[model samples]
Target: PDFKPLPKTNQSVGIDLGITDFAILSDGRKVDNQRFTTKMEQKLKREQRKLSRRYEQAKKDNRDVRECKNYQKQRMKVARLHERVAFQREDFLNKRSTELIRHYDPICIENLNAKGMLKNHKLAKAIRDVSWSMFIEKLMYKAKWYGRNIVKIDRFYPSSQLCYVCGHRDGKKSLEIREWTCPACHTPLDRDVNASRNILAEGLRLFETTQP
Candidate 1:
């Protein structure tokens, strides 16, 4: 049998979490948005409607409803729909996270303030679907199991606003501005990538300065 030691590096990968871009790796790698929940929402809703209708009919029939085979069949159908959606979402996340773990040696990602973000009513559903917390939890343990490191940077760091090329800070680029040309370096920026790069650079600097 042959065994090999993992590579030791003085570098790390940073990631930015979002809905438009599922993940942006610090080294300018873009992982496409795999909106598993968003894609299944419509179908799930339709199934829920069918389930609700069955429940309503059962209610109307009262004591006699429990004996009906059709009601029992519809109940099982609805349960299967829910099971399918859960599997789809779990499968997508597992695949994406596994790919990242395989590609990067040391991964760093922002410690997301999930509760704070949920306060924004408009983003609530989208945030819930992205499941940032779950992703981080899985990634952290996987990295440990594979002899890789997962670093959680502070949430307050301005990954998106800082120019990765020139370190220029621009306060004007808000959440609405998805893509922008950097004012300092004249480089085109994909918002997520720019943020991810900044995160990676900052993490490297932090790792060096703190000797972590």
Candidate 2:
């Protein structure tokens, strides 16, 4: 199919990506994290255990594991479980990316260091399940296909730390601190929403400077 640019809209958005919520928009809308992998984890584990038992049974029977019909069948079941999870996650990412491109002219987001983030063992699994890198890739390609712009703010930007209302540079806040009142402006803020707004502001600023 020949791809055509979508009709332009005045709408622009900044997105903050997180594990709690898949994405938080500057407009205060949140896309809930589906946790596809986690949801399927138990079933997958059971199937894998069954596959292992089948393999062990094959070994005891003096049959090649690869040649054992029961082992192969169980292996395929485990493989299908993994495939289902991957497909679900990919479908979700594709839909969200396309929806954003269709509605927004210039989408802004923070340049996340996903690899560095995965270094935290406690967060690695959750982060992988969210598949931030894959989502960003989809957004980038879809933006190009749909004639939308993707603006990425610097990774080093203190988006979550700064107050979006008064631009006060508050010190680091832990992940548990989801909401706070701005010390400078006394305005209440949702951490993710505030970060998104900051990203939008910074992205637009950068976009303006880059324009001829």
Candidate 3:
């Protein structure tokens, strides 16, 4: 299966991965992020609370928690919820990566510093829920299996801040500034769209450097 090379195509895509959506592709496509954790959080907390209460009750009764039926049953229920979330995320990533591999050549994405991003307490939960690192790993492994290429542009490339239409660095933008017009060309830009285009350009540049 790994031996079959992908069909030659003139397509190269840059993807901007984010918490709000799965990815923003350079080809004007947006894949919505599956917020699995957020969807299951309430249910998980309920199950966990039940398990905790059972543990506390067992302790109060001077009973061995291992020998307690309620404690054990609640524990298993909570465990299954966690497993469901994990499986759902994996399934989504696998399908998305496979589709991308089949279509695009030399996919480009940011070399994001997830660890550093997580340090922001306000955004930590959102960042953790998206699982960027895991998604990238899945995309990469599938790319190798199918004999495709992936490019990781430098983390500090400023994909969002720079104008894709005219090589102009407008300035740093806050997360809230989702849309802006380029000062140089007066070209209207959607933040993610411009970033995707820039990513595609960078990925293609990197690919050329590796070729004989």
Q: Mark the 10 consecutive residues where model 3 has the least summed lDDT.
A: 1-10
1-212, model 2: which lDDT tens digit per residue?
56799998999899999999999999999999999999999999899999989888888888898888888888888999999999999999999988898999689999999999999999999999999999999999988777789999999999999898899999899999999999889999999999999999998999888889
Candidate 3 residue lDDT tens string, 1-212: 53577786767899998878779999889999889999999999998988989999999999999999999988989999999999998888888988898998889999999999999999899888888899899888888877888999999898998899997998898999999999999999999989999988888998899999
* Angstrom error at residue 189, model 3: 0.6
- RMSD, every candidate, angstroms: 2.9, 1.0, 1.2
Worst 10 residues of 2 by lDDT: 1-10
TM-score of each: 0.87, 0.97, 0.96
**Could you tell me the TM-score of candidate 1?**
0.87
lDDT of 2 at 162: 88
Off by over 4 Å in 2: none
lDDT (CA) for every model shown?
0.79, 0.93, 0.90
Ranking the candidates on TM-score from highest down gives 2, 3, 1
Error of 1 at 7 (Å): 4.3
Candidate 3 wrongly placed segments (more than 4 Å): 1-3
